[model samples]
Target: LQKACQSQENNRAGLGADKKEWIRTEDILERLEKVSDDRIYRVKDALRLGVPVNSVKKLTNIDPWYLMQIKELVKLENELMKFNIPEDIPEDFFRTLKVHGYSDAQIAWLMRVEEKDVTRQRKKLDIRRTYKMVDTCAAEFEAKTPYFYSTFDTENESIPSDRKKIVVLGSGPNRIGQGIEFDYCCVHGVKAAKEAGYEAIMINCNPETVSTDFDIADKLYFEPIYWEHIEEILELEKPEGVIVQLGGQTALKLAEKIVNAGYNIIGSSFDAMDLAEDRGRFSDLLKNENIPYPRYGVAEDVDEALRIANEVSYPVLVRPSYVLGGQRMRIVINDEELERHVLSIFKHMPDNRVLIDQFLERAKEAEVDAIFDGEELLIMGIMEHIEPAGIHSGDSSAVLPTYSLSEQAIETMKKYTAQLAKALNIKGLINIQFAIKDDHVYVIEANPRASRTTPFIAKAYQVPFLNIATHVMLGSKKIKDFEFEKKLEGYAIKVPVFSFNKFPNVDKQLGPEMKSTGEAIRFIDDLNDPFFRKLDSERSMYLSR
Candidate 1:
């Protein structure tokens, strides 16, 4: 059961919670595995309910050592629940809780208060974290590339540098929607910052990524991307600014918190990010700009969603705000399906509103990755999706230099992209998706930071798009500073790679939700070749296992 739970945890790390398909077959083996995992938690519940460790082990075959550990943790949680704040608890006890890996959110959960209140209480109690360096050698030689981790200690080894520094938050872990792509951006972003003569610091918990390489940044903090962890690092490092845009959704979600903590977010402001992420606000912006967007409505509950579904007619696209890789996004054909999906979405995001858009069934989908420096915009690359509008862009095969769109359509897309970048007051990278139906283009969505396609576009254009965008965010470059190629000489296709065989009994159809774990690029000089013609005609290329 423990091994099964570990396997599920690993799978969850890879696929992420958001990328899971809501509708799928119920494989008994999978169900049994899940039951095993749930039983581990059920043991915790039993212990909390005053069950004996020996009884738990007898009933659940879990080792006594593990059961005792869970019992101790529950005991501590119950003890902590008696105190309202850190100030109310003993200093040594609070320190022990921190050392025991109790996050602000977890403490707040037990105390029945907001996480911020716990954080404030900790601040008032002077219960702050300290940093210690990861000594690779046995203290025989000083580690040249010093990487640090946080702990509740008095002695600190990571001394603050007086030199100007920029902190680049890294995408925490590799998941289906956001894997190595954002790490590619972070690597380049730190290099660009270093080249710009600023000491670059990177904060990330994932050791599998190149961005977490000891040599990648001048100083690396091996820490979670949680708000409390980030705040502690920022408090210690005192960086000139923090770059949140390049780290995908994980780091992007922390932008507001970083700003509220009085740290400068180097790229687009939080308001700009919010404007792009909030569906209602973005739809209003599109309307104000006279940019065509799919008829959409925001709903806070099931009745509102049903009303919007009826008004928009059948077959609507539903998604939550501020999500990446089409997380919790669905296409429903009728009111019944709408209610089911909306209810499930609400179950996950109880406080947030769901966005409903008129599903453009057969529209050609395209996206643009561009850079903006407050005043000017440069389109990095425009990719046309081979899988049409309904499929998630991450799972779709995207061809750069837009093989099918008319020149006028391309120009119009570029214009609309620039307009959005300007309206959002974007200072770095921006990605916008569009759908073309009946020869008219409509804005699908916009992201005010680097998208998964940024790296693909950079390679397609044979330019350092990430580096250029980083410099722009650092106030070191402008759109006119570098000349771009007037025309792309070749076509670059981004092909999504899936791992359907790894997960048994999983649905294998491409849809609005992203499923691909990785991507590969194919560059071609000619599209008229017989093989290329076959690929174009079929719109898919498959490889045998």
Candidate 2:
């Protein structure tokens, strides 16, 4: 060590005994090993203490590749500190990426982590990045970006003087066909804004969608929906008001955040949204309103989950407390499959928080889309699912202006939808899914924000849903009192499109889980000859519309 220092000093100007040749001294190696966490820390100190770099390397022999790993680790930590991580990452995300032909360096590059620091926070956040789950990667990273100034404003943006007011919130493409639906909302929202002689402003990240095509809104900003980015949009483009409930949960969630951040929101409150999502709360609400739902229980651990699973008689549905669309949901018919799928997800999530319920089969499913302004509820229309209730409505075939409805069932459905809407005090579009078994109506789910079916309803009914929702956000009341463009012609059927053939080995069957690439809506009133919703060999379907 002393000799190493002498060589470094010799290269410099003349020096005294302080730079004299020296030998390795007692306890230096032991002292270093006892305190230094890694070679880089030791090297930094040695260089600061005037010891030669070569001598440090010669003594430690730490691999250059390993040093690079350490640096990457530090960089990744700094990055994560800026943003939050999502509750879900592909199971075995890193390992799966590796198996699917990604090198360690490549995996590290994509994850922005050091090869050395890829340790799982829990096995749940393990390295998995299947094509299906890839889009979720940016959510957490985007969420963590440090907020900017001017994102917080206690005052809401006022309406325009020269034009009508339309505020658009975008839902970026996540898994399934959700992205296109948002585009649908943006297109109609802007059109509605134009019809009402108002300016339209949009916030979205996806440039690939039609919403980002520039002509959709007067002002379009490609910003992350993080609190910081959204708050920035709210501050800069203070429109008459904000729209949240039209773009699905991602947009709605951000809207809730905006409300929490002290900005004026144009739709339902965050508390109302929470009631619509929580299974226990929702079920209780339904019961209180005399709406029937399947018997269910919340499970906290394996023992309780298993017990509930047994009571539900093998076939049961399991879903997380808060999810966009059944991301981890599944139907289990046996103990083995139950244990395989249930254990991992339940173990990671809050115990006794999962909705474990008996699976209802052979139930005719239907949907009701409506509009409200916190005072009165207006039923937009009722539609029946082409497939049974088990298939995700997004993936199921649906007919607008339901066919098999009994007058009693129709009246009951309308009343329940209105009741739920009024009780929630929501001020925008709301969709409710119900299943009729033995002539009893059961409320399955409710979306305070837009459902996948919103675009279909708007296009079919020729209603400016975006404009109406926008007005509701601005304190307008009574959708019935306002005139709506009558566009319902004949009948419409919405058929789902899939890319399963292009991506092999993906599970195709649906339940609470959603898995459709896109959809097509067909219009025809000739109920005489039924068409079989044609699917080309490529999994793309062409509907009449």
Candidate 3:
């Protein structure tokens, strides 16, 4: 829609009159049906291109009322092109824009200005967002649930409470890389907050999540996990602190924004997060701490990426920084693949920095989930990946109480986890990945927030690790205060479940990028038991099927 709007503006400036391109209605229907998320935008685009409403409706079978609604939004966008930011715009104009669900980022794009500039203008004009309660009853009886959604109206139903509160942001949606695992962490964190005598407020957009249930948190805000929505919620609630460490990368990306807005992050500071996320800075930290890591280098362009790959040798793992689920990650075995991967990455994310590291093939992979209270660290559990280092952790089958690692390697990983937690000042949960080759331990990466394995480990060991970490973040408990059992009696395996039938033609091979949509767990008294072997065989056969 934005592209179509820009094209219309260009045509007006260059041709001096609106010209319509004759397109078939069948093509419009094809675009609408194939691109599910952009159907409404496609309608707006078709209308902007002068596709008649009668033709569109006759082919697409969409109601005319809906088409008119989209037409209004398109008209609004055309009017928006005439104004600039912070000047020549009436204060009341934003109220209408907000009523039409125009985010500050969208307005900024239309006005060809930075998003922050639009934000500053909105603040200057005091055109803040208001909240409306999601009432099940239509005022026949008073609704007791505190669920709310944002709007540009005058009356606000979500009144601030005097009691101290902590805001927990939920992972936005369920997808291949991030799924219900992070939602498990968020739900546990909210429960812990209420148990610690503070009202818990949850901000999430997914209605399918347990955290979005009306009774899960003291107050629920069913809003997008974007910075603008989160900032508005914080502006109204003024919570004592915000917990971002349990919500996965979706919430973790907003750490700097929350800090810059003068709100307190309940756990590790933004600098710590940056230190862990920034490839060069993290490598420097590991070098200073005498930690073993794969040889790596950062790059900004194709030439630099190829140079790093040559230095690191062949079979290098390349990925963009500050990404979760190993999105756009690959193992390039030669210069040709390196150039191709770097070009593809830059084409999609032009401003992103690429991190090229030596790929450890046939190396055993393990992960550790631990917690820290600024002074002491507790290792929750250690999971050994059934597959090797190349497969993304989320897509790999992992066995808890590590079935294959030697005692020495396990101790070394635990020591490294503690050292990193203390060095990074982690107050809540931390997940660290390790690669073992020739009896040597190397740190692959570190995540300051909860991992997808958090819930799996908790269920297998019957431990409340998330609860403990939440208390640690709230400063109400320490690692020494809890009686944590690090060792388990039996073996537990987490097998990745894929929905291949739903997505036709997708490659079934697991690699650096995650592909599994969900997971299933299996437990047994012995790893060599017949039932365990049978289940393992079934899991192995799934990939081929």
Candidate 4:
């Protein structure tokens, strides 16, 4: 049991728990080994945190005599430094040195010891570094399976068996502002469905993600989110609804494929998602709704892209039609860079259907993570980026209760966000990013699917957006039936973690592109603790680093 506990302790480290609970060794050794009084007296103080001898013997079934010898040796070796002794000192001399501090020459004169005895004792005290292999069984015991993870709540919901099965598509990997946080939405949807007695499925490829954990959904496909593969799942599951809105772009892009294949889209309909994205369509929405947006032009070829770029002016933003993790998005500062980027994006897409828009300079970036039951607009949390508009939000240090924006700007943000959610007919979570300059607010991007801030806000605000979305999809929830009067008063930071340094020679840049592998959530309320907050933000206590 001692060995078993130690094995589990080492394995638990992978879970990213800060200040892990540790064990002790002396008590266990003394009791189990039954050491002679002389040996015990010689080496007792050197042992670290561990179990008692009886407990160790009860757990490992090792003989007491051998354990005694090992324990005594460990004690003698470890305590050599404590006695102010040299590395060459023999164990017998430990008693002499403990009584008095001395150099090798003085000890040799009094105890008839060799000068080299001091050196030997110090060397024996040095222990080799030990590395433990992670025990897979620890995960098996602590983690949930695909089915049970969906029901985090102890309460149960009553639903008919005829209810349509719904599965939320998953955003595969970690990106700045994104990561396991996206799965918070995924888990929410699953739990909602399960509570309402509906089957919830999740389709994703990233194994390291939280949603992929065994019990997040009723059934996890562990499949890639591509048109080819998703179409097949639609055919088999024949789900009454497919939740494209909570899964991010991977799910959003698949929405059309499902519709074209004549399958039902669970949360936001294909048309609604299209209105939110499809640069041309979104532009039309801004015009129809009288919403403010940056000037934009869709280019079909390099010549067209260059022409549109010229019209939009230098330092314009260009984005490809269907990409993930901000695959080919950038601010081209000059014609040369523009030319190279355009060619590269065109080469990546080949067809060249990209949108170029004017870059809003020096604007504060804000985001609204909201929920809608396809009717009532539920504002979960408003997230503001510390970085300016040009930085990929996922890469930016985000804060709740946006500090710098004017009240009017925040109002405009909330209004537009609600409007966007309602217009898109979103039945789940929606994360919208905006660039606000002075009194003017411009639409940056709106994801009909679960935005990166889902978990951060959910945890920060103490609201259950994911569970609500699932209930709505299953027709268990009605808009306006429930109300919330919560406001994000305190601050929360969703800081991104990177392994680029681990990948030698990796280019480090934050733009309208995502480059992050994981994130940590922290609740902060102190202005005086900004430095501590910043340091706390460096490493997350809950993340699997």
Error of 3 at 436 (Å): 0.8
User: Candidate 4 on 429-516: residue-level lDDT in tens?
Assistant: 6778889898799887787777677767777777666676556666688756556555455677777777788777656766777777
* Candidate 3: pairs in clash: none
Provide the TM-score for each candidate, comma-separated: 0.90, 0.66, 0.91, 0.65
- Candidate 2, residue 423: lDDT: 83
List candidate 4 segments past 4 Å from native.
Answer: 1-164, 173-178, 483-489, 532-545
Rank by lDDT, highest first: 3, 1, 4, 2
lDDT of each: 0.81, 0.62, 0.83, 0.63
Give candidate 3 regions above 4 Å deviation: 1-43, 54-61, 138-140, 484-488, 531-545
Candidate topping lDDT: 3
Q: Write the per-residue lDDT of candidate 3 for residues 18-76, one digit (tens) a residue.
A: 22222566666678655464465556557867778886687568999878777777687
**Candidate 2 lDDT by residue in tens digits, 1-545:** 21122112112111111122123433343444443423334443344345544554557776555444334433433343443332233444433333333323223343455533433332245332211112223575633211122211233232224554556777754456365887777666656655556667776666677876655666565544444345545644556666777667667766556777576666777778888887778888888888778888777666777788888675788776666656677777877776666677755553426678777777888998888887777677788876766777777778887766788988889888989998877778789989888788888888887777877887888876666765665554356658866587677888878888977876665666777878888887755435633321222222100
| Tens digits of per-residue lDDT for model 1, 1-545 | 22122122222211111122122223322332344534555565566667677866666566898778767767787788788765587878887777766766667667767778878877887888888889877799987557888788889889998999999998887888888999999999999999999999998888899998898899999887767678888998899999999999888888998999899999899999999998888989999999999899999899999999899887899998777778888888888888899999988767678999999878899999999998888888889987768888898888887888998899999889988998999999999999998779999999888999998888777788899999999998887887766345778889889898888776777778888999998877877756446656755333100
Best by TM-score: 3
In angstroms, the error of model 1 at 451 is 0.8
Worst 10 residues of 4 by lDDT: 9-18
Report the Cα lDDT for candidate 1: 0.81
Worst 10 residues of 3 by lDDT: 9-18
Colliding residue pairs in candidate 1:
none
